[model samples]
Target: MISLEKDAGLWIVTIDRQDKANSLTPQMLEQLCEIAESAREAQALILTGAGRVFSAGADLEAARAGLATSPLWERLSGAIARLPGLTVAALNGTAAGGALGMVLACDLRLAVPEAKLFYPVMKLGFLPQPSDPVRLTALIGPARAKMILMAGQKIPVEEAQLWGLIDRLAPPDSLLAEARALCADTLGASPAHAAAIKAMIR
Candidate 1:
């Protein structure tokens, strides 16, 4: 489902469903939320997926099987949004649908050069969660958010960076290094001060 590796002050969380491009299941989401709740003491947090994907998005089969409103699902999405730690998404590959939503929730996002970003919730005949659209618009502006969500447009990493969806870009091979640098910078700040600044921003 998900793997957690704590390296000194940093906590690394990886989605490990490589067979399905690391698609998120309700149970996996629950585990993630639980792990994140217990990781408040960490200096920084990094999220990435196994194999080549950051995530393919929500598990559609599970959703159709009535898992969408489960407590695990809610906790997964809501907890990430409220995480007190400095969070970063290391987008190692493509991100779509709920995967894009997850990236938007993070405090910062770094994408590999070949990665792609898009939301297909509309094409799937579903509306994205309110917070997803709100956060996307906040980061990239209403117009850009509308263009992506309404049009189901897949933005390349370079374009996503230009539009402000991604904060940094790196070669696929150096993506981890870039993510590490960003995490190091974030962890340099006092956790208490970081929390205060985040609270003030909200």
Candidate 2:
């Protein structure tokens, strides 16, 4: 499930399936892609999760039912990455598996102090989607990326911040508020200049 809210210049997208650790289903991914496409006019966008868990990655049942595919994941990640303005991932809790791709796609990431991040593809006996490793490497470098994707390391928020996987850490209760403040600060930059910088960096 997904919920969208507009606050001033920011569009907030929340994954609301907390009962299942907010695991993403194929349908949910599709919906997110659509939302990302439509949110281009907003000055900034924030992707987060309701309750706690940001996302547990692909829903196992959907994968087992053959409803999940690398292409679908790519579409969702690509959509988020291509957003014209600033994009931020407010990691309210842990992020795992394919969910890492979504977080990486964002221009910036803020996580709660208790949040943890990992990609369990190796432990799950499958390779991460091709683009995932590439994105992770681009953000955190090959060695650390290997530690996460190949060694199946679970990184807590403090280490993640030190490694540049997350930009800031906030207390659980204030995570979203901090993310919104960051977004608001980013709005001080001209949209055109911000977009250009993001494009150049990518």
Candidate 3:
């Protein structure tokens, strides 16, 4: 369940499975990876969830059925991370579990004031994908990463922003508008320069 819309030089991608908290299935991940691969032609890309929840993470039912794995999550998130242009995660709501990987992969993250973020791998008795921990540590450092991944703590929007996990907070009603504005601000830079700087730092 994914919706892609092109607006000028921007591509907005939304997860459309609100009935399941927008939890991602293998097919959904594949689609997302495909979009990420093709988004290089756009000036920027924005990823968000349709209804309330941004993403509840991997589909547990599918995982239980042996239909999902860390590799699939890695493939999807890695694609997003490798995107040449600016990529933003517009967190309309909370993000949890493997969904955090997607949020972390984005070049910038903008969350609604009500958004919360967490990873419950330890609480769920599951080992987080190796890349997940590495990315988390790179963004917010080892201590904060430990609190989030090892302790299963819920990070509210304010703390997440202070910790550098979220770059800004927008009101729920204006989240997408804010994300677009942020993307517009980055348009002055040539895509080649931006991609080069991003690759060097990341």
Predictions ranked by TM-score, top down?
3, 2, 1
Cα-based lDDT for every prediction:
0.80, 0.86, 0.87
Stretch of 10 with least lDDT, candidate 3: 63-72
lDDT of 1: 0.80
Candidate achieving the largest lDDT: 3
* Candidate 3: Cα lDDT at 89: 96
After superposition, which runs of candidate 1 have C-alpha atoms over 4 Å from their true positions? 68-74
What's the C-alpha lDDT at position 173 in model 2?
85
* lDDT by residue for model 2 (15-71), tens: 999889999898898898889888777789999998879999889998667534557
Candidate 2 or 1, higher lDDT: 2
By descending lDDT, how would the candidates be arranged?
Answer: 3, 2, 1
Which ranges in model 3 have alpha carbons more than 4 Å from their true place? none
Clashing pairs in 1: none
Q: Write the per-residue lDDT of candidate 1 for residues 1-202, one digit (tens) a residue.
A: 7988888778988898999988878778767778877777787788887778898877879867755434554455566667776788999899887767667878889988888898876777777766788888888898999888898899998999998889998777877777778778558888887778777877
Lowest summed lDDT across 10 adjacent residues in model 2 is found at: 63-72
Comparing 1 with 2 on TM-score, the higher-scoring candidate is: 2
